[model samples]
Target: DRGAEMEWISQYPHEKEILLPPLVGFQAINTRVERKTLVVELRPSLNLKSPTIEEVIGKLKSSYLTLLDILKGSLQAEALVGPSEERTELHESKAKAAEELGLQRKAHEETNPRWFNNALNYQEASTAAFAIDAKMATKSILAEMKTSGAYTATFGGYQMHKLGLTGL
Candidate 1:
């Protein structure tokens, strides 16, 4: 039956204990005709103890890394197609995701700077994060393109960096 064939792909880990949030999952329906995709957005259960601000920040960082891995071909092939033609789309999507992650991370930082600082004080440097910033850096790209008349729109807030564009 159609109902029996529906499957949901979880983006974030789901713990029996709640409190942790921003949970997200996607539902996909495959049939003889075409494919259908839906986002299973969940408001965190929020049952567990309130996590310290640092815990949320750490989760955001981990989520970012997980997404980076997803974009870097680290996930199961069946999960994310990562097609060549869809590279740009994937890259752009990741950029937006990363931006959201960064904003959340920054919000945590603002609330608990000391905890955030201490948590990251001992962590290893994120090379891929830095590289993604470099490859996807679009401020200068847009500036140069503007002068060349290649881009006409005024860029406001944009996170245009991604590892998928390294070859390009």
Candidate 2:
């Protein structure tokens, strides 16, 4: 198994560039139809099993860290202009982002209270990932998003979804 996994990973590039989709101005936060685009790529040769709950939550959590990294990185780059203004802008930006994320969390909770509440470990990770995006993006309790570089997953359980995402 280790050999197979290594062989699989070795075939890919060591580094990748990820571009986060913009948090669509205002119209983006609320969707009348909770439709999402999930791209799935099957590797017949690999025949991988559905990602476990831990893997799903882990990947989702990493993505939050990635977003924060991007946010901090850009804010730092902008700070060179004026430290005070940058601080104000950073505070406002974070507040706006948090507000939109909270709205999104409420929407998802209405539809799938168990999954949304469970995967987010019952709290917004408020210290982290905007909250809703990770579980939704990962389809931790839903369906489909894949690429040769991305992962495929099955619907996860209420209990297991909490395993790898809490206290972090």
Candidate 3:
């Protein structure tokens, strides 16, 4: 039953090929209908280097613009078809969807940069803390060896210090 429903929705002429904007560092992996809603999954594409924050923000803005354009076009098409109860309902739904999308875009623009900066700051602080801890651990080990009276011993008339550090 669910499969049949999904197939029907997908077969709708106007619903075919939802035009998505070009996205940087991301690609659409899959799309399916869950209940009455369409769910699309986007995965980050592998790259030798990551994109800058500004690039990410720009992509987001472009995608938002594309969505608005699609919604506007749909509204215009509906207008050309003349007035009917079904058309009226569809128009209202489209308007509400557009409004909701606009709100989401605004929220993302306001918060995403701050969230990214906080995450970067936290990573830097954690790395510094770990480095300091490692240094202290190494120093403590050296101090313990000194306190235990471990001294360089001579072998075959050669001082242990003469060997220095070596790797096999």
Query: How many residue pairs clash in each candidate at the backbone level?
Result: 1, 1, 0
User: Where is model 1 more than 4 Å wrong at Cα?
Assistant: 1-47, 51-125, 138-168
C-alpha TM-scores of all predictions: 0.21, 0.25, 0.25
Q: Looking at model 1, which ten-residue stretch has the lowest summed lDDT?
A: 1-10
Show pairs that collide, candidate 1. 136-161
lDDT of each: 0.44, 0.41, 0.46
Residue-level lDDT tens digits of model 2 in 1-168 = 111234334545664433222221122233243357544432222224655555564564444444555544443343344455445543454445545554543444334333433555434543344333343323322221333435444444543345434412
Ranking by lDDT: 3, 1, 2
Q: Top model by lDDT, which number?
A: 3
lDDT of 1 by residue, 64-166 (tens): 4554454444222322446656545445544554564455444444343333245464242244344444443454355446669855654334234432223
The positional error of residue 70 in candidate 1, measured at the CA in angstroms, is 11
Stretches > 4 Å off in candidate 2: 1-44, 47-54, 82-123, 126-168
lDDT measured at residue 7 in model 2 versus the true structure, 0 to 100: 32
Model 1 misses residue 32 by how many Å?
Answer: 72
Error of 1 at 137 (Å): 1.7
